[model samples]
Target: MNIKYNLVVLAAFCCTAIGSAQDIVTQEQAVKLALENNYGIKIAKQAVEVAENNTSVLNSGYLPTLTGAAGATYNLDNTEAEFSNGAPPTSLKGAESNRYNASVNLNYTIFDGLGRQYNYKSLKEQYQLSELQARETIENTVLQLFSVYYSVAQLTENLDALQETLEVSKDRLVRAQYQFDYGQNTKLGVLNAEVDINNDSINIISSYQELKNAKRDLNVVLGNALNPEFAVSTAIDFKLQFQKDDLFEKAKTHNVALLQTEKNIAISELDIKSNKSGFLPTIGLSGTYGWNKNNNNGASFVSVSTNTGLSGGLNLSWNLFDGGSTIIKVRNAKVNLETQKLQKENILIGIQRDFENAWEDFENKLKIFNIQQQNIITSQNNFERTQENFKIGQVNSIEFRQAQLNLLNAELSRNQAKYQAKLAELQLLQLSGELLNVDF
Candidate 1:
């Protein structure tokens, strides 16, 4: 029967608007706020932006570089000149000489064993990797949000149950007082009922402490720095069932870590090719335009000189030998590639193992939920019979308290089982890289 859920009437918790006291936050809204305000997510998204900015030909060496330069030098010195023809020697008291030159140059790599091409590809791959990393960050944050959010829900439910039982205790106290007035009960019976009332009060107070702490935790997860007073939906959707094979397949295909590792492998292979490019000839084209002027003061011949020119050239260079550094680099790149391949395998296996455990845990939690469901029914029924008997003086305070506590315990266990089962489902979806897709 659905009595377990109907008893609390909290399954529709998410839809209930916040009372006049506070705003009601739902799971989806919490995630959205965190995405907007969480610092870690902001940083991760910036990392992706940087990667995207790097994926350009200008940054990847596919385009030519243009540069401009200018410089001038001046000197003051005693000057003397001797002509090579030996006509005469001349001297001046102060001699001034200056030189100025400027140029705009362009250089382009025509080829380098296609290294630039590999570099471009690597940059694009890096961008993809960054995006995946950001996604991983987001998913983690979302999972954390759910965990803390669920804690708040569980505590809220428990607090409500405690308050409900407290009312029962109050009623019992009234009954005991009435019986005592009529001389049907002793002072001890009245004292016992009052003590139980006090104990329930203590339990409710303690639960309030716990519930407040849970709210603070939820506040942090929501990225609400102000910690404003708020309410949350206790309802979590647990109706979805998962299959083992489907999760396994989806994890292999979509798990952020696995996809990132695969990208690393591809980048590593590109690194090997990039390093091997060192052994091939590098051909490049270069051009320059320049202007220069020089003045020699107190000198014998041609005191002022000016020159300007445009120049262009093509060049090729081959690194025939480099003390085995190139070979070492190529070999290291290949080793890195192998390492990436190993990591990919390890991730694949790791996700599978996690899925195995989580799937089994999910199934077991569902079974336990069913068991708890049945147990609560029995507990509730027994409590009702005991309560009626106590009212008629057929049972004592201890027996009545036992029945009350049993029913309360059943409520707690059932709720705990339900929340735990929901957590398992979230974990399974997260492992399958479908948490955002499912929940959002």
Candidate 2:
């Protein structure tokens, strides 16, 4: 009965341990989680919202401003006054007075040399620029996530390969021991086998550490708790079908960075137009309605008075001269407009270069991947044959170890090539502004 109870406890502990392990996370899930939780993306979204809010007509000065105010004041004083022309003198003690006023005023810019119109257009363009910037931020974050996710996958594969190598080394050690016990192999052979096993063990430990570090990095990108343990589904295959010319065309039109620079150029051109408006006159209209009342005490001829009135007017303002500052501003705006044009051109050039480089990298990596795929099969066959020969004393321990190492190295190379190809593929998609839209 006591033994049964201990077994139940042990089983429960094992179940709990299994249940506590982290769930497997896929690349899509990682991207979704990061888009939802990443602080940078959230901030970027807020900035986009701010720009949207600023694009309103009210913010662009297209609406009239109206204000209303009312106030009253009371005064208590001892007063003495003399009229020089009439030769009269008057004095009052503890005199009390009150005044009240209320007004409503409205003002609107009737005309400003089309400055307001250009300003509104610029604001709309700025909002678009901010949206593109936000998308750029999201794209960058997704790229980082992909890089880390695949890195974890690569390391995990390498670790598995190393574990297999360690197992092979252990098998070699066992065979060497058996042969030595049977007087068919020297003690030196057994020692060498043990050393190989130890070396493989060391490598396995190092690979595990690297895998852990990579997973930690992935967790950071996922905006999860650091150092959390989780498995990632490996994505080792990628297909590229777009031509360079087509991709370049898409990049020129769809790339977020390039689109943003183009918007900037548009805004700069609008600024030049707006600054040039300074040479023209501004027209405005304003109106006000008000009531005023005053009360006087102690020896005043008029005891109380009230007045109400309505007023309206149009006003024009022209900056005829200001130390040549308007001319300077217009010149500067033109220069800035030119600078923006140059920047747009530079961005276009950069996008072309990036697309070309990423395409070449993908092509090269795909070739390497194909070669490694063949190499892995050869190495695997060689290791198996070497293992069979070693078991029958036809192959020495060193040759068996070499075969094992060759298989391990080949597998590692294959894994690296696959991941590098995927990375290049992702880079190409990113440059073409298609990564965010594609299903990973």
Identify the leading candidate in terms of TM-score: 1
User: Against the unseen true structure, what C-alpha lDDT does each candidate score?
Assistant: 0.83, 0.83
- Alpha-carbon runs more than 4 Å astray in model 1: 1-20, 84-86, 225-227, 239-242
For residues 379-417, what per-residue lDDT tens digits would candidate 2 score against the true structure?
A: 999999998998887888889888988999999999999
Position 426, candidate 2: lDDT = 86
Query: Tens digit of lDDT per residue, candidate 1, span 325-428?
Result: 99999999999999999998999889989989988999999899889999999999999999989878898999999999999989888889988998888888
| Model 2 quality (TM-score) | 0.90
RMSD of 2: 5.4
lDDT minimum window of 10 residues, candidate 2 = 10-19
- Models 1 onward score TM values of 0.91, 0.90
Q: Distance (Å) between predicted and true CA of 426, model 1?
A: 0.6
Candidate 1 least-lDDT 10 residues:
11-20
